[model samples]
Target: MGAMSHPHHPGELAAPDPVRLLAVRDTPLSLDEVFAAVGDDAAGGTALFVGTVRDHDGGADVAGLGYSAHPSAEAELRRVAQKVVDDFPVRALAAVHRVGELAVGDLAVVVAVSCPHRAEAFAACRRLIDDLKSEVPIWKHQNFADGTEEWVGA
Candidate 1:
């Protein structure tokens, strides 16, 4: 019971935060870097996710897209990562999101999580990406081949 309790609770120990990397960059994302950042000797499982720009979306032919992030985007991203570390037994975690113009098939984001088991790693990685997408102040401007444009999550 003592070990299971959180530090905020009376007589409990605080676990070290497991966020290893967090970034919102205008350059292309690197899967290797993200994966390496989450490497942990104690971790038996590692889960990784990469988001890529596709040529089509919602029946429209996407020509390209540009991502723009608010000044606080990186800080918000760290908050999301910290939440995942607190909720899961994350041994290590990393995430990087790309900004600026990206062509179809470009890597838009890369995230990885390592844990003592496969299930935990997968769950943490999923939650990290989901929360980042919804909570971060990153907007996407998509251009269609038909000369149409749309803003998403602005």
Candidate 2:
């Protein structure tokens, strides 16, 4: 038997090539690469958001955080990115999430979106990161200053 293709949603055009880059890497993320990916002549505005590990979370002093991801993390990230593209007038998009251990000031994730207007770019960029955090199969192991550790979003 042959595989069956899913039908498109109402008013859905073919999935546009809005994603310029999407990835999950063990090394540090590059802000330059993310910004470059969303460089488009048609776009009048570009917005970028970078999430970094901080010294505290929920009132606890965090020494550092170690990120771990399931094998499907990248695929889930793409799915989230696609949703952003489908919902926005995105000219281009890029997102990268870092894995492995990171210090308080290390960059954990970077997302960028470009659109014809600044408002659209800002909204799309926000959606990309919010959805990515809620939907992706990545967990954070936080080490506290008092020698305690906890895994978040596991």
Candidate 3:
């Protein structure tokens, strides 16, 4: 048989696209912007995640860090967000990642998701952040206090 197709059940409507914002920017990330992007009146709950640059990693004191992204990074982020929306009853979704040099405690990424219930919103938000970290073509260059450096997720 040729390619098999799965069809929607009778009276079942397809889900509307819920992704509102997706960006990889060289400026600071704003939690308020991300949270606002996912605002949905029909949603019973909204979950948000913020990733920040820390002072230490792998037993080393971090001095600072910088992030760089490939040209395709934004497209890959869209793919990851769409996957989350397809798996959950997402009413709205938004994600933003920061590039360029960043100091400790600076926001690295922010993601938010809204759904009909709290659990779905939380789960979808978590999945969106985790997948964005692992699957996107963004790399980090971390500098340590000891004059050493390392690259992660390159």
lDDT of each: 0.89, 0.90, 0.90
**Candidate 1 residue pairs that clash:** none
Per model, state how many residue pairs clash: 0, 0, 0
Identify the superior model by lDDT, candidate 1 or candidate 3: 3
Tens-digit per-residue lDDT, 1-154, candidate 3: 7965669432132137689999999988888899899887778889999999999999999999999999999999999999998888888999999999999999999999988888988999999999999999999999999999999998
lDDT of 2 by residue, 1-154 (tens): 9966768432233225879899999998999999999998778889999999999998999999999999999999999998988898888899999999999999999999988778888998999999999999999999999999999998
Give the per-residue lDDT digits (tens) of candidate 1, residues 104-136. 999999999988888988998999999999999
User: What is the alpha-carbon lDDT for the whole of candidate 3?
Assistant: 0.90
TM-score of each prediction: 0.89, 0.88, 0.90
lDDT of 2: 0.90
lDDT of 1 at 67: 96
Model 2 stretches astray by more than 4 angstroms: 1-16
Query: Using alpha carbons, what is the TM-score of model 2?
Result: 0.88
The Cα error of candidate 1 at residue 89, in Å, is 0.5
- Model 1 has an lDDT value of 0.89
What is the lDDT for 144 in model 3? 100
